[model samples]
Target: MFQNRHNLSERQVEILVGNLLRYGVLFSSALVLLGGVLYLIYHGKETPNYQIFRGEPPAFRSPEGVATSALSGRRRGIIQLGLLLLIATPVARVAFSLLAFMRQRDITYIILTLIVLTGLIISFIAG
Candidate 1:
C-alpha cells in the first residue's frame, strides 16, 4: 500500500498546475461578472460627470477591507476582491512550483522558485 502512494510525475504536476490556473481565472472572472451585474443594477441610471474624478474608497484598498466589504455584499468591493484574486493566482502558481520543486528534491529549482516567490511577496507588500 505504501508503494502505491507514489509521487506525481512531471506531466501530472503540470496538469495540476494548469488546472489550478484555469480554475482560478475562471472563478475570479465569475466574481467580477457577478459584481459588475450587481453594480449595474444598482447604479445604471446614474448620470456620469466627466469633469469630476473620484477614486476607490479606502474600504476597497486593502485585502482585509475588500474581504470585509465583499462579505457585506458591496458591489465595488466584490469587484476589487475579484481583481485581487486575479493577482493572487500567479503568486499561488509560483508557490505551488516551489512546493513541487521541494518535493522533487530539485535544489536549484527550489531556490529559484523561492526567490521568485519572495520577490512577488515583497512587491505586493511594498506596494
Candidate 2:
C-alpha cells in the first residue's frame, strides 16, 4: 500500500526521516555534552549568586548570534546551538516530508505540510 510509482517508496522515505531525526538528536546531544563539559571545566569552581537574576546575553538570543558564538568556542553558545539544532530537527523532517509528498504528487499532504511549515516559520519569526 505504501509503494509509489516512482523509485522513492514511502517506506524508504520513512527510513530516511527516521535516520535524520536520530542523527540530528545524537549530534545535538553531543554538542550540548561538549559544551557542558567545557563550561564545567572553566566555571566549575565559581559560586552562583542566587540574589541576582541574569538573563541570557543578547549574543545568544538569535540563530546567527548563536552560530557565531558557537563557532567562536563560547560554551553557552554551543549549548544554545545544540538546542537550536534540536528544535530544527522536526522542522527539517517536516520540510523533507513536504518534498517527499511533492515527489509523490500527494497534493493534500503537500498542502498540509506547507501550512504547518508556514506556521512554524511564523512562530519563529514572531518569537
Candidate 3:
C-alpha cells in the first residue's frame, strides 16, 4: 500500500532557472504595464482639450448659446488620472524593487531598480 505523500523534491527547481523565470516575469510584465501607462499619458498630452499652452480658446457655441471652454470637466478628470498613473507607476516600481533588493540581496532586483530609477529621473528632467 502507498500513500499520496508530499514530496518536497518534486517542487524544487534549479536556482538559476527559477530566478530567471521570476525576474523575467517581473520585468516583462512591468515593462508591458509601463507601456500602457505611457500610452495613456502620451494620448492625454496630445489631446487638444488637455493642452495647457493653447493661448486662445476656439470660438464655439455652447449648449447655452455661448462660447464654452475646451477645458471641459470630463477631459480634466481623464487627463488627471492618466498623468497620475504615468508618474506613479515607475516611482512605485523602483521603491518596491529597492526594498526587495535590500531584503533578499538579489542582483536582479538591483539591476531593475537602477533601470527604473534612471528612467524616472530622466523622464522628469527631460519632460
Candidate 4:
C-alpha cells in the first residue's frame, strides 16, 4: 500500500510558488543593482554628446555579444544578463507549476498547465 498517496497539498504548492516568485524578483533586482553600480563605475567619467543620440555599442547588441562582454566585465552586458534572468523567472514559474500539477495527479490542471508551458516554449522559439 502506498503511504500518504496525497502528498503535497494545493496550499503548500501555492506557498512554494509564491516563495519562488519572491526570491526570483529579489535575485534579479540584486543583479540589476550590481550592474548599475558597475555601469557607473565604468562610464561615469565619459562625456556623452547629448545633441546626437547614440545607440549601444556592438558588444551590447545580441545575447552572445552581451554574454561575451559580460564575461569581460562590461556593465551593459551584465545589465542585459540581469534582464534576461528577469524574463526567465516567469517561464521558470510556469515550469514549476507544470511539475506540481503532475505531482498532484490533477488531470485538468495538468493539461492546462501543459498547454501554457507549450505556448511559452513556442513563443520563445518563434522569437
Candidate 5:
C-alpha cells in the first residue's frame, strides 16, 4: 500500500476550517460595523420620511454599484460591500473544503463537494 506524505490529520483540517470561519466572520463583521458607523456619522441627523416607500438609490442596488460607492466613500456602499463579504464567507468555506478534500485524496467528498459547489453556482446565477 502507498501512503501520501502530505496528508494531514483530521484534527488539523478541522482547526484550519474553524479558523477560516472565525476569521471570515470577524473580518466581515468589522467591515459592517465600520460601514454602520460611517453611515450614522453621515446621516444621523436626517429626519425620517416614512409615509412614502422610496426605494434605495440606484447606486446601492448591485455589486458594481456598491463597489463604486465604497470607493467613493459612500457609507451605504460600504455597508453593501460588507454584506457582500458576509454572503461570500460561506461560499469561500465551501471552496476551501473542496480544496482540502482534493488535497486529502478524498474522492467521495471531493465529488460531493463539487456537486454542492455546482448547485451553489447555478442557484446564484439563475435565481
Candidate 6:
C-alpha cells in the first residue's frame, strides 16, 4: 500500500507543478498590464476633462478637500491587487491537485477546470 501511494505522490507533483506555471503566467502578466495602465494614467497626456476639474472640489476647492486623481489611482491599485489574488488562489489549488492527477491520470484536471470556469462565470454575471 505504501509503495503504491508514493508512486502516486510523485506523479501528482509533476502535474501540479505544470498547473502552477499557468497561474504564474497570469499574475506576472497582470502585473505588467497594471504597470502599463499606471504609467498611462500618470503621464499619458492632458485632456479637457483634467482641465475642467483642475480647480474643482478634487483640487482643494471643495469643503472636504480631496485629490481626486491620487485617491482614484490608489483605489484602483488596491482593486487590481485584489483581482490578482482572486485569480491566483484557485489556480494554485488546481495546480496542487494537478500533481495528484498526473500520478493517477484521472479526472482531476477536468473537474478542477470546470470549477474554475464556473466561478469565473458566476463572478462575471454577478458583478
lDDT: worst 10-residue window of model 4: 1-10
If ranked by TM-score, best first, what sequence of candidates would result? 2, 1, 5, 4, 3, 6
Q: What is the C-alpha lDDT of each candidate?
A: 0.89, 0.95, 0.50, 0.84, 0.85, 0.56
Candidate 5 total steric clashes = 0
Question: In terms of lDDT, which candidate is stronger, 4 or 5?
Answer: 5
Candidate 1 C-alpha lDDT tens digits along 1-127: 3433235467678988999899999999999999999999999899999898898788987899999999999999888889889999999999998888888889999999999999999999899
Q: Better model by lDDT, 1 or 4? A: 1
| Model 4 C-alpha lDDT versus the unseen true structure | 0.84
Q: Number of clashes in every candidate structure?
A: 0, 0, 0, 0, 0, 4
**Model 4 ranges with Cα > 4 A deviation:** 1-8, 49-68
TM-scores, all models, native as reference: 0.90, 0.92, 0.35, 0.77, 0.83, 0.33
Candidate 4 C-alpha lDDT tens digits along 13-106: 8888999888988888887889999899888899988999888788766678878877887787788878877878898999999898888788
Misplaced by over 4 Å in model 6 are 1-3, 46-127
Where is model 3 more than 4 Å wrong at Cα? 1-78
Residue 72 CA displacement from its true place in model 3, Å: 15
lDDT of 5 by residue, 39-63 (tens): 8998899998999998989997777
How much does candidate 3 score in TM-score?
Answer: 0.35
Q: Which 10-residue span in candidate 6 carries the lowest summed lDDT?
A: 56-65
- How much lDDT does candidate 5 score? 0.85
Tens digit of per-residue lDDT, candidate 3, span 1-127: 5533233322332343355456655654554455456556767566465655654223321222111221342333333334444445546646655765655567886787888788887886676
Candidate 2 per-residue lDDT over residues 11-117, each given as its tens digit: 78999999999999999999999999999999999999999999989998889999999999999999999999999999999999999999899999999999999
- The best candidate by lDDT is 2
Candidate 6 per-residue lDDT over residues 4-42, each given as its tens digit: 876777666766666676666677567547755776777
| TM-score, cand. 5 | 0.83
Residue 119 local lDDT, model 1: 96
